[model samples]
Target: MALAVEERRETVAAGAARDRFRWWGPVGVAVFAGVLRLWDLPYPNAFVFDETYYPKDAWSLLQQGYEAVWPDNANELILGVPQVIPLSQEGAFVAHPPLGKWAIAVGERFWGLHPFGWRIVVAVLGALSVLILARIGRRLFRSTLLGCVAALLLSVDGLQFVMSRVGLLDGVSAFFVLAAFGCLLVDRDRTRELLRAARAEGGRAGDELRLGGRPWRVAAGVLLGAACAVKWNGLQVLAVFTVLTLLWDRAGRRAAGAWRPWRSMLRRDLWPAALSMVGSALVVYVLSWSGWFASDGGYGRHWADGRAGLSPERTPLVDVPLPQVSMSWVPAPLRSLWHYHAQMYDFNTGLSSPHTYQSNPWSWLVQGRPVSMYWEQVPDGQRGCASADGCASQILALGTPFLWWTACFALAYVLYRWFFRRDWRSGAILAGVAGIYLPWFQYQHRTTFSFYMVLLVPFLCLAVTQMLGAMLGPAGCPPRRRRWGAAGAGLIVLAIVGCFAYFHPLYTAEVIPMSEWRDRMWFTSWI
Candidate 1:
């Protein structure tokens, strides 16, 4: 009897330890990630790659309530000690939406229009992404260890690291998508639990059940909308995920032994799900353009005010008064916004200008071509360079090679699990990949870059972590098999970390011997 009590006490202690680790491990990893992204963030002291566009736009939004044109010497003047914001009153045509720039403006409002100012919000978002992914992995895999592993993998990824350090829209958009995904995951669990409870409470299996207002699903919609507000591609994700959730509802009803599960889902769940996710998303997306709509100086804000054909007008081309837009009754601001969207769509789709660093989507998983966000040749005795030959400083937006390559295999494995084993977790991860990554394939002919894969990195990390969890095997497996599997998984993780360390210099604009930089460049295409 005494021994039984002792064993029970031991088991309780072990469970408590796991509970503590479940929280602390992910938090610890997030803190580590935050440090990696935030350390010396202001170094290089210049706009890196697309930073030339987004940060400037952000500053303009803060001052003028719209993106305004800047002078030719804006970069030089902005970098000076006494910074000058040379913003023109005239609005500029921007392809993407304003939410991302607004996020950067938040940082700039606090720190001024400097590197640290523009980059801080994204860096913080990036770190929060790590924590979010960790929690998400934990929920998906039912293992805190795997969750922390996933967070660690993302934290060390070169592309994620570089994108986080730079002021860019993709990383910001990715954060919203990830958060929305997490919200859906929570909704899935909550829905299942509610179904099970109803069944237990003497409710018939075929009874039409009404789950209360699913706040999580509503939150997911708003987040996905925010993602769209950052970039238009987020609309694709919102569409796919909306379908995914409805399908999940069907599956949940079927699992609860409901007759005609699909019919029931349509009858009971369809419209509510649509309203919570799609309706909320549309609201958030439009609201994100408040600055543009509110400001008279915004590009195209007055587009419909004096346009002859927009309103019924006697035109030379037509005998009767004819309106160019059939929906002439629409409000002017919304009509102008729609016209602006049409132009944005055309510009984004038609862009095929040649860029030296442009890469194909097919080559993204292999790190075939990395964008050089910043590059400079530092002469000896300058910028702390100690080499006899000139040192090179660069921030190459590349994924850690071994990690990415492993993710390729993991992705295949996940597809198999989703197809053959019918794993919901695998399907969810693949849904994210499809939403973010597959859309780019349609734009293949248009100029695309591998760094755009930043949006897909979180899903890839989740896949890799899931595979590692499988390698660790199920708990009931033979001890020897578990040991060997754990060893193999551990080695792969170590290799990923080692590769991250090896390429750390490239992710940060660290000055190193040109030979060393060249050595890290595994492919000529990477240059």
Candidate 2:
């Protein structure tokens, strides 16, 4: 009996130590993520790719309430000399919503109009995303090592890195979406705590349903709203979160022994959930347009007043509700702005451009096609090359192969956990990918590219780490199984990091000899 007790105590102690492995893992992963993101952040010297759009648009937003037009060939002007280019008063019918543009503007204000300055915001946000995933993983897996693994995977994802180092609206959208996901996570813990408290308060939760006022739910709504303000696809994110949170609420009530879980949710969950998540979201979204609302020059600011381009059929009387009704004084620009949006929406939904980099939605997970952000000929015998033998060089925008490949398996694992284990962590991953990727299928004919998946990249990586943690089995599997699991996961991670380093030059637009560059192209599609 004494021997058995001592053996049991030893097992408990071992389990305790295993749990502690995650204590400092997040910090180590953080340092790794930050270092890789910050290195050569402003490489390529000039705006590498879409940095041309968001950074300039951000500057324009700062100068004006809404997005305004630039002179023809504005990128060249912005790229050269003084480098602080502002937009003209004429409104540009930007296809995307304004929130992301505002985020870029905020970055520009802090970092100045330089490439490094604009990129600083991207890097910071991307790093914060890593931290968010780490925290989420820690909470979900109850293992710090697992969380760190998630962060490490995200940090080394070539696509995420490149996206982070360039100014783009997608990063801003991703930031809000991740924030919303984090809020839901917080809500989960808070709800569980409430249930525990109810159980302890002599309220037998085994047969009685308990409900709690969830603050994190409100927080999630606010973040989702911010996402919508940033991009239209954010609407999809908001929808997914709404369902995911409500379902969580329902599950919470059921676990607490609510006699009618569905009824309890409908009665106690529906209204607050709607107002808190949906209503709060609406408020946040409108607030993102505050600059446009305040500025008289904003495209649609005076639409109600009937300005230029307002068709009689589309423009309603502006003074119907007002005491001082006078259509004679309405602004033309506002009317034009209203019409502009309708047209922009039409254009976006109807976009059918032949983009070389565009890839099908089915191909995104495997990275079947990499967008060529930039390419130039290093003529034979020229510019640091013995490439007198026809050298081919290009920046083929692609994710690190190891990172993407692991994500594939990770996502599959998440599917298993979501359905079989009914894990909330797995559900969150579903919400993110569904909102970001699945919707793209409907817009298959539209001009879309693989780079947009950068928003889902972190969550995809987290899915991978979550599986690794589960496979490792709570630090209590047979010694052989544990050893193999650790080794396998470690090797996979190391391989991903190695691949990231190998592709760093192409990702960062490093000028390489044609032959050397072509050597990295494992796929014809990559060219």
Candidate 3:
């Protein structure tokens, strides 16, 4: 009796310690990520890769409520001492929606239109993403240790690190998508808790209980809409996640012992779910275009006024004739917006122009063709280059090789666990991967770069952390087995850290000897 009591006390103490670590551990990792991203953030003073387009557009949106034309030497002039921002009054036809530029504009508005200004907001979001992933992992796996591991892995990923430092839409949009996933996870837990509470109150197992408006689900919809406002790809994520949440609802009802759970799900949950997720998302998505709707100079803002464009009588891709005569009651602004969407769709699907850094989506997982965002060759004596030979500085948007390759195996293991063992956590992580990744396969003919894989990194980290938790074995496992598993998982993490350190220079555009840089390029394709 005495020994049992002591064991109980010890177990309770351990649980309390873990509970305390949960808050500090994830926050510590997030802080570390922030320092790495924000340190010397303005190193490459000039525009890197696509920075020229997005940052200028952000400035235009800040000034004119729409993307405006810039002078030919805008990049050079913007960086000049006097900072000549010669923006034209004419609006430019931007492909992406405006929210991401607005996100960048927030930082630029306060810090001035410089490198640090545009990149600051993205860097902060990137760090926050790490914290969010950590929290998500904790909730999914029920282990603070595993949550910290997931966050640490994301903090070191080269692609995430680089994207955070650059003024691009992908990183900001990724934050919203990940946040929505987190919200859905919370909604899942809340739903199960409510079902359990109803049972505790002596409610019948098959009772069609009405859970009041799911605020978490609604929040998720708003975040998804924000993601779509940043990029069209977010719509795919929104669709997949909507289906996922509904399936979760069905499962929840079934688990609550409801007979004919599918029927109950449709009758009781369908409308509410649709209104909460899809309806709210649609509203937010339309509201995100308020700037475009308000601006007369916005591209296609007046397309209904007899502009020289293809008639909206038919859809662009399918050539399906629309009943425009009957639908003429729709507002002219909405009509112009619909027409603009068609033009945007055509541009997005048809963009196959050759690019030096373009890579097929199939090769993305293997880091086959990392995009060279910025590169500069330098003589040995210039810019802290101490080598006798030439020096090289470059920002390569590549995933940490060891971490990503390990994740490939982890992904396979996660698939097995989800398919064969019916693990819900694995399925959730895979949902994110599928939603963010699978859609790109259809666009393989278009020019795509490996850097876009940044959105998929958090999910990959979760998969890896889950696999590591498995390696660590269950708490009831034999001592020897647990020891060996811990050793193996620890070694893998150490290897990932070493690999990240090895390639840190390429990620940050640090000047290094040409020979050293060449050595870091394990594959010629990476160059």
Best by lDDT: 1
Candidate order, TM-score descending: 3, 1, 2
Error of 1 at 356 (Å): 0.7
Q: Which residue runs of candidate 2 sit more than 4 Å off their true CA positions?
A: 1-24, 83-87, 202-213, 307-341, 379-386, 389-394
Ranking by lDDT: 1, 3, 2
Each candidate structure's TM-score, on Cα atoms with residue i matched to residue i, is 0.94, 0.87, 0.95
lDDT of 2 by residue, 366-476 (tens): 889988776666666765655566554455568888888888988888899889988877887888889888999998788888988888887888888877776676666
Model 2 misses residue 53 by how many Å?
2.1
| Two-way lDDT contest, 1 vs 3, winner | 1
Better of 1 and 3 by TM-score: 3
> What lDDT score goes with residue 331 in model 3?
70
Every candidate's CA RMSD: 3.6, 5.4, 2.9
How many pairs collide in each candidate, listed in order?
A: 0, 6, 0
Per-candidate Cα lDDT values, in order, are 0.91, 0.76, 0.90
How well does candidate 1 score on lDDT at residue 339? 70
| Candidate 2, residue 102: how far the Cα is off, in Å | 1.9
